[model samples]
Target: MADYLLESLGLLLRWLHIVAAIAWIGESFYFVMLDRSLKPAADGDAAIAGEQWSVHGGGFYRKQKLVGAPAQMPADLHWSKWKAYTTWLSGFALLSLLYLSSPQMYLVDPGVNALGSDQAVLAAIALMVLAWLGYDLLCRLCGFREGLLGALVALWVIGLCLACTGLFAGRAAYLLVGAALGTIMAANVFFVIIPGQRRMVAALGRGEAVDPVPGLRGKQRSVHNTYFTLPVVFAMLSVHYATAYAHPHNAWVLILFMAAAALIRQFFVVWHSGKRAWGLLGVGSAILLATFAWLAPTRNATSAVTPNSAVAAPMHATELPAADTAEIQKIMKLHCTACHSAQPSLMASAPKDLRLDEAQQIERHAALIRRQVVDLRIMPPGNITSLSEAERLQIARWADTLAVDPAFK
Candidate 1:
């Protein structure tokens, strides 16, 4: 009963978290698109101040506001909040359960770094805190509304992301960066935004005027959050791919994926904002190419050598059993030759090492396919290629048929 209760709570929490995130991101996107699409009012910048006009969701929604502050408090004025706070709170809980405590498997990558699991988790937390602090300091020093601030923040984030990826497993690094980013977005609300609104409300209650600077700051931070949503979503998913995480140059690949997603987001942002569709189309094209580059697996330095022991080794030539050479060749060609081939006699992606171009190479790494396709369910990631379960089962069965001679096993 206790276990059942815990499981039920977990499911409910996840559902709520997902809904909240959707609301937060959805509002963020709507505001971004609306802000960009807003046009200058014909009546001049009055009726309020520092305002814009837009038509959305089958109606014209005019969001006009005082350049400074309203003269008096209206009986009913809706507050735009809770979305940010709830999103942050829920995301924090999820991260804590998924990564912060599970240092055993999620935080440390023995293959990549020499650090122990405990050391890795500590490093992750420290880095996350540092990233948030550094970004906050940068904002204060540079001025959030300043154009250079955005570019500087992006550059700094990329640097920190690279460092984290190099230090930890690919997924942890990405999540750490995400946590930091999420912190900034939430802080913008809790620290900068809500406080500003409070001040405005207090002024209104006192029948006085509020300042615009705080609103500007809030808007700037809000815009930043909008741009972050798409890329962070993609980064969150990238961790599941062993090709992306365990690859020799995993960090570099992650960087490319982030940049590409950002570009794609920008492309859509421009298109919805009514810019030249071609420019947006070009960005879309670039995103596709970038994704292709990231997924198109290439061999890494560490994967070159096969271990002498079959237990830990990526299968090798000397270890192959007396399986039907012709049948094995046919299976590899039909099932894997599409992506794992160097020349890729079929589709795209040679996918980080393990070329299925030859019979010997296939035999050497048959066990890898078995593990990835059968055991891991990580290959054909996102089911992009739709590899059938039968194919995966066939590979696994063939692998099982291999002779378990002590010398090889």
Candidate 2:
């Protein structure tokens, strides 16, 4: 696309996505904490299950709540539902704009399949839907709401990470996983959660007793959303560490990362719920993540070089002719360094960690470019980089022209 159009569209929706995400996540975190901190009402006289008092912005603020009826409903009760829904919507728009419609180079890994955009998109949607359906079913199972549910769901999520990441590129896998989570979240909101809340509201409107079961179901889904949040964030941002997605056994690495992200999230949840050191659960989760990481095949997190002073393989400067190197560098600086450089040095900015600053950096990342841009057309992002079709072909051809993975340890 023309730079003006790509830049214009990316700029606009990205801003909306950011604003919406802040609202969604901020509200989610606050409510989860609120519910957890709520205590049993002494004498059962409190109108709400929880009440909190805090000083913020240098003033004391007290909040009150209720299990259902508040004696009488407030004239103005703000609904926070749209924050989450809109955030997911904006994110979906961004995903489609940047990753779906553009060339396959940025999101597709030809290593998986040299697919046309139509086929790749179909695959992406199918996988995301499949993941959500599987997870929803797991939650709806007969015994899924009790003690074993958490463990079962966790394992099921792990299995999903392994299966889906195996079929797609690493960054693509990570993204689809995030998308799957978003879908589940939206489904939870629309199907189970919203309906349950509506039922409660209707009962209240009709002067009928609001049963706590709907509230409980809503709470269950909300908790699931909280547990799912961290890994979703991690997966959304994993494109930066191409290495994570580029590991030799890539799927296992995703499984490891997801587990690690979830474990870290759990720590916060338990801590916030006022159980600071639930040692057994915490330590057990820690060990589980550690075990997974130990099993992942890690390349140098940044470079192909080994930790030892000995190089992985001798450098072959002659293999890339000086002219070719200069041309490749020129192409990168012209088309990519804008948003992908060390400082990005272009526009207001791009996000972090996908920086490309030097020649060695470019060559070292040749396979990635080929996989993401050349073969998959997954980068230069939505053609926002204004990389021409010819340039795309050249870049891929250049990456493939390399004879071997000389940097492999």
Candidate 3:
């Protein structure tokens, strides 16, 4: 009952997080597009920087960007801060409920670094906090020099990626990086953008000359947030792609993926500004293709027949012996059924409804098992079930046999 309740809460939080993130990101993208698509004011008003005309829902609208505060403040100005706040709040709740609550199973990987559960949770939190502080400091120190600041931020991101992959389970590390980026985005809104807007509004209300510095700062942070959108979204979605996260060079993989996402986003940004940069798209596509080729598993490798035995060299799939179902069943019972059976002992329900209590069910998911258990080695997360290497190899051998058979293939 407790597990079920927790699962339900996680579901609710995830839903709320997604909805709020969509709202925030939609607003960000819309504004960025509108700004880029704007033309010079038709009447050449000194106070107006640019204006755009658009038709939506059978109505024509003209939007204007003022150089500074208008002569009079509007009575009911809408603020965009709440969506960002809601996204961060719901996302943090979900992170706490899922990863922090069971750090042993989700966050800490003994093979990577044997951090205690509490320590792992603290590290995750600290990463998000420190990321925001460091990024904010960099913005303050190098705000005038955009190129230098961009290089520094890139270095910082690479360092964080390396640190995360080294410290936690790969899946958790990816999610943590996403969370860190998300924190920085939300903080940009809370600490810089929103505050700057508020100050400008306050100044306008007081009949004081509105300072342009705050508005400039707000624009800078908003641009940063827009660039971060695709990368952060990719990182968040990467949990589903074990091939990327579980690779031997996962940090580099993550960095490359983010670079690709940023490049693709840059293409869109340029396009919105009445420019074409096909090279950006081409470069991003090349990176993705290279990464895909790199992550493809080498299937010709030999597997250990047992824990005490050694295979002297790699052997082809055809040369391998047929798998023993009884042995496979035993291994599954020991390592997988706890969380993957019809009545999972460790969770409210079998994850993804992949019950392996029956032979037919196990055989049905053989390819999936091989990918998760053998190729990626990301299942039984954090090695919580202590799945032995020999057992994994056995599963791999079985999967390889299936690959060679036409019916199974």
Q: Which candidate number would show the highest TM-score if scored against the true structure?
A: 3
The stretch of ten residues in a row with the least summed lDDT in candidate 2 is 303-312
Task: Give the Å shift of residue 375 in candidate 1.
Answer: 12
Estimate every model's Cα lDDT from 0 to 1: 0.65, 0.67, 0.87
Please say which candidate is ahead in lDDT: 1 or 2: 2
Per-residue lDDT tens digits of candidate 3, residues 163-214?
A: 9999999999999999999999999999999999999999989999889888
Better of 2 and 3 by lDDT: 3
What's the distance in Å from true for residue 173, model 3? 0.7
Which rank order by lDDT, best down to worst? 3, 2, 1
Model 3 TM-score, 2 decimals: 0.93
**What TM-score does prediction 1 earn?**
0.70
Model 3 regions lying over 4 Å from their true place: 301-323, 402-409
**Per-candidate TM-score against the hidden true structure:** 0.70, 0.73, 0.93
Give the number of the best model, judged by lDDT.
Answer: 3
- lDDT (10s digit) by residue, model 2, range 164-238: 566565677777778888788877887788888889888888899889877787788888888788778877787
User: Can you rank all candidates by TM-score, best first?
Assistant: 3, 2, 1
